[model samples]
Target: MRSHHSLTNKAWAEFHVDGLPHVHRVFPNGESTMAIVDGLVHGDYVAAAVNDTAVTLTLFSWPASSISRYCYAIHLQIGRVEGPTGRLAVCVQVTAAREVSPVEDYWCMTVDERVALFDRGNAHPVATFRLEYENQRTVELPK
Candidate 1:
């Protein structure tokens, strides 16, 4: 995944998985809310949604050589760092489907538990993004 922050303060992210590309833009809607817009690409699918607390971006792809499907998602939430002043930060969580499972079994798991499992090392290529708010939000991309 690659991201860009424009001069207009619009944050854009692009994900390339299994040779498919998906792009999305995230910007502040009001003082507390956020808005997202996605570009439509053929073959794969991307969905972006924002609520009162967070913005989530999910990517879905079908591999030609496998019967199993793959899903990758990122959730961004505003939070505060541990301190007396309690500086603002953005807490990001990334989750990817590990394997195919029966529909019944999948439905039994809650979203929180699944994310916990991924955090416990059940998923590969895990990452955390910490955007600190001083005068503006600044992101340090992984090198």
Candidate 2:
């Protein structure tokens, strides 16, 4: 039987974007903000360390720069809130879900990779998360 190495590797390396961060309409017009996680380059990966274990996620994004002459597409795999500045509830909640699976998740703006090499050679932001879901500190039991 073929070893499940590939699946195992994908599990720990790729991100499962359970929810995409969205702006909250209730907040004041000026208070609301939205930024696309740029995904214009390969090897440009992001991750999130929730409890302590690193979790993988899928990535998607908008078009590349305007100077490019050829058409292009984009892909993304967001992990954590790199440096969120707006309200936590609306700005970073969805982007920071505890559990995310493909069976029960929906994302906006699915990368319509119509043109090839759209997100090529561009810089993108990344996020990381630990698996642990608590706020406990470590302490030596006894020497």
Candidate 3:
């Protein structure tokens, strides 16, 4: 049998009030995709930290079979690192290409209908909400 994902909703949001890990989230498509309260990742990934927060997240994989090095860095400003004594590291190292892989396995999709991937620096939406609350729908790709 396949192992189920561990990032349930409660754990992701509350960060373990009972001194344990693993989150639980539910949605209409829980069987197809998990509920992501925020953010998403694609391809092989891992996020870790020594404190309740982290110093950084790095990627050092090849683009394919090439040997070119891509230099990238991530800096975080978190409130957990201020003054705490927790020894925990939550690592999610996974990758999937399916449209639902992130939504299902990683909970990458947003629950808020207003969140978007891109913006035009305007105070409006680039896409319209024509979705029906009664059915599953396919995403419309831009040409």
lDDT of each: 0.39, 0.27, 0.26
What digit string (tens of lDDT, one per residue) describes model 2 on residues 1-143?
Answer: 12365322222232323333222112223232123235222222223333322233333233233332222222232233334332111112112111111212112322232112233345333443333123346898996
TM per candidate comes to 0.32, 0.20, 0.19
lDDT tens per residue, model 1, 110-139 = 433333333224454457767876554579
TM-score of 2: 0.20
- What lDDT does model 3 reach? 0.26
Tell me, by TM-score, which candidate is best: 1
Q: lDDT of candidate 1 vs native?
A: 0.39
Model 2 has an lDDT value of 0.27
Error of 2 at 143 (Å): 37
Clashes of 2: 30
- Whichever of 1 and 2 has more TM-score, that candidate is 1
Clashes of each: 0, 30, 6
**What residue pairs are clashing in model 3?**
8-23, 8-24, 9-24, 9-25, 33-104, 34-104
